[model samples]
Target chain A: MERKYWEEEIETMPRRQLEKLQVERLRKTVEIAMGSKFYAPIFRERGITPESINSVEDIKRFPFTTKNDLRSTYPFGIASVPLQKVIRLHSSSGTTGNPTVILHTRRDIDEWADAMARSMYATGLRDTDIIQNTSGYGMFTGGLGIQYAAERLGAMTVPAAAGNSLRQFKFIQDFGTTALHCIPSYATRLAAVFKEQGVDPRDTTVRIMIIGAEPHSEAQRQRIEELWGCKAYNNFGMSEMCGPGVAIECQEQNGMHIWEDNYIVEILDPVTLEPVPEGELGELVLTTLNREAMPLFRYRTRDLTRILPGECPCGRTHRRLQRFQGRSDDMMIVKGVNIFPIQIEKILMQFPELASDFLITLETVGDNDEMTVQVELAKATDDFQLLDNLRREIARRLKDEILLTPKVQLVGKGVIPQSDGKAVRVKDLRQNH
Target chain B: MKTIKQLSIFLENRQGSLKRILSALSDQNIEIQAASVADTNDYGILRLITSNQTKAAALLSDIGVLVNVNEVLAISIEDNVAAFSATISSLTDNGVVINYLYTFSKDGRLVLIVRPADMEKAELVASAQGFQLIQGWE
Candidate 1:
């Protein structure tokens, strides 16, 4: 059967017209961005203005905005609109430091809903399909952000939030939920739970699985599809822009198509901060073209992936991003929880018996991604009780910091392969995401 | 109250890894007194008592292997069913938690290797039970 789009004309818009629209929106975004208390002074000092960006290429002239910039502008410092105009705010887990906050007005939320509606539609989710959003709701954008989009698409949405696997299964079977949105790792875990109950995933009415908010491999996507006997589509988005509707894979199952009208996508060498060659893997940089509350300019996403250099079979002119290869930074996504290497290092530094010569290993044991931290016992450390107790305490500290449990193993002094040069800290041996 | 030094070597679960570790020590003419491998899906801990643990660990480290030396309680008891039963009862009665226990035949002697949660309690129980306790065996 031929595929249908929710917004066919925009999805397959001509390249010339798409670029013109991007330039127009880019200029508008710059003007709105200047209203931000965070950017207004920068614009004045740097001699940057809306008139300065005559075309999309001129966007590069305006200095790049990094995650550090957002961190420094914590709270609503970066908001262009007044506090009264902002309707909602979502923040990332900031246990180690200040969390990145995203502010949105009513119009921004509606626009995000439209983008998410298209995201769901491209993956074969229609208004007739019942959607169960399993992403975390509160501070996380994945939960409520997509809920609005599904409702905007006229789909009966169940804001089931996260966890409660038994109730999740009941809602799926009882409501005949057709669209499933969640992290691939949790989906894998839930699939195993259902298997234990002797439930055949094919018997369920789930037809379209939108897996995103965490990077996963194509093999993982296929595994999820085989388990549920349904199509698993990949989506790409971050809280800095909107939510999970920035891009999504069509039924073609090629790469994720990022909407050009809402955001300008760029792949740049993280070190040099220059654009990479076509189809070359580099750090993904994005600019929010239509964000009224907080219009971001050249915000570095740190996600490393190449652009699939071709048109999609589903006929969406928007360029597609290849499967996430790895991150430019040392951000580790453990079971859908984002973790930084420094966080682990910082925790390890506090323990004296541990010499901090440790390696973080990511491996897939069955359907679950397990993080194992192999640390070295200090040379003079001979107290077995202290070592065992310290291991448990370190695990508790890590769980408190990252909100995920990790296997803490005490290895030999030289077991982790340290050297005079810069040592590799992470070893990812998992099949995919 | 003497203690036995047991070598705990970390081995990634793969074919011939155990054989490689065993052969590596044997190649050096180092004899493994008593050996056992506790395995998981990814890795294994090969625990062995050797007369030359310091040399064995040094040799393994030289060959880029990971090994640790831990002091454990090794007891020599009569090669009988009641001997093993009494051995456990002695420790459990004294509130000693047995982390793990394995036995092997060496020189016609039935030796029970025990790693306890409480080292002090284990040593005390073994002393009072009249079982000949060897610090660590070759």
Candidate 2:
């Protein structure tokens, strides 16, 4: 159930030893990237020699890869390895536009699974637990990535790829799923379904619920625990970054312990491209230290978070990162106040009378940005005044929580539309206004 | 007994816009007593009896939903008031503009529906000027 490499290097390595390993991996990755067709041009354009990059500190010399760079390269643009060696490819949700394609080799796949196994063990998941992976499978890395790790960890995995709430409930009851790997929002949705069906989620045998793919608040984490009657853990990783198990919340649940041996994480100011002080919020820049097929150097993740250095309470030497605040692109500025949709969502979920299905719309009325929270009512009632009460409660809550007043709307059940892939929780219609 | 105010809101026919209107009211703590929707191809009429009618109209107006207060009476009687002249005469004699009207009863109470030209003035007159307004079951 233990990964030998991770155990030997990550858990035991001292600060000096880990840095030495990172420098060695960084040097090798640079040499490999320089010889490849994709990264050779980037290196040549920057007028940097592969031999010049000897240590991890030399990573700053290379230009950071952004999502735009990935798109411009298009298809197999930034891939350092040959197409023949690439066994699998995972793409982003392309929510912003085109999906960023990520290629993986057999070795790379094994490393990913190993890293996930370490993450699972770090979070207290055992082989005896039946892991139900509710993340989407097909093109998304969530389902396949977690599925491999669960299997690798000797845990029985139910590859229940998202949706079908009823069947998922039946599987959890019938199969006795002790661990759940899915988004926190879906976990809450399932809890709601159980309530509507007159079933108690607390009475079930689910022990741990692993949530990822979306940013969630502490309030949300507590709510998920209250709903499922299980400890909810958060993992932070993107499809491009090797999916959910890149960093996992240990038993302490304070912060996600980053696998420093595989990935060198740096908190950098998004505008200045300079390193921020520890515990300060900045964009997460990651350098894949050991990625053979595609080793990214200082890849701009655009994920806002702070890095917490030191040994974890779980006895791991790797640095942990604070929970992702929100994506830089998703941060909405209304009336000179910065607002995150997750913040509003956390507030809404606090009310038992409210459903999880809600939408936040930002419209620019004149020069000011106006926000409208469209929440779906669970049932049909003749009480229109109850709707008014809910609206005022939301407005009051938003004013207290976000320091902004937004118009609240209560719609009929199933009135708000649903999305296929990752749910489109917020719609920015400011440009139209 | 405190009098409750009923509002007839005119909503445009669009995709999922009604929900937005209702969410606004629900957030404001205006409890709806009884409600019904009359829909056409162009627009829909949302009829609502709320515990706090003044607050509901103001909240709806702030959110850009056209709503107006109507002074209706809930009297304990059998059958609907077939004579419209009596209802109109009661308000018309007091310099009230009869904009539109509807009537329904609940729990053996006869409800008389009346909409004045100016909802604010109508509500003020109904409350302060001794116009009999409907109250839900005690």
Q: Could you say which candidate leads in DockQ?
A: 1
DockQ of 1: 0.06
Per residue, candidate 1 scores C-alpha lDDT tens digits across B1-138 of: 578888877666557767877888889898877888776554567888876898998988787566778888888888888978887887898888988878888778788888888888778777877768876645
lDDT of 2 by residue, B1-138 (tens): 334456777554577667887788788866666676766554456888776777778877776565666455433334445434554564566677855556666566556565556656556655654545656532
Reference-based lDDT, residue A413, model 1: 45
Q: In model 2 chain A, which range of ten residues has the least summed lDDT?
A: A377-386
What's each prediction's TM-score?
0.61, 0.60
DockQ-based CAPRI category assigned to the predicted complex of candidate 1: incorrect
lDDT score, candidate 1, position A379: 40
**What would you estimate as the lDDT of candidate 2?**
0.76
The digit string of per-residue lDDT tens for model 1 on A325-386 reads 66778877888886767568768888876775789999999999999998776542223455
> Whole-model lDDT for model 1 versus the true structure?
0.83
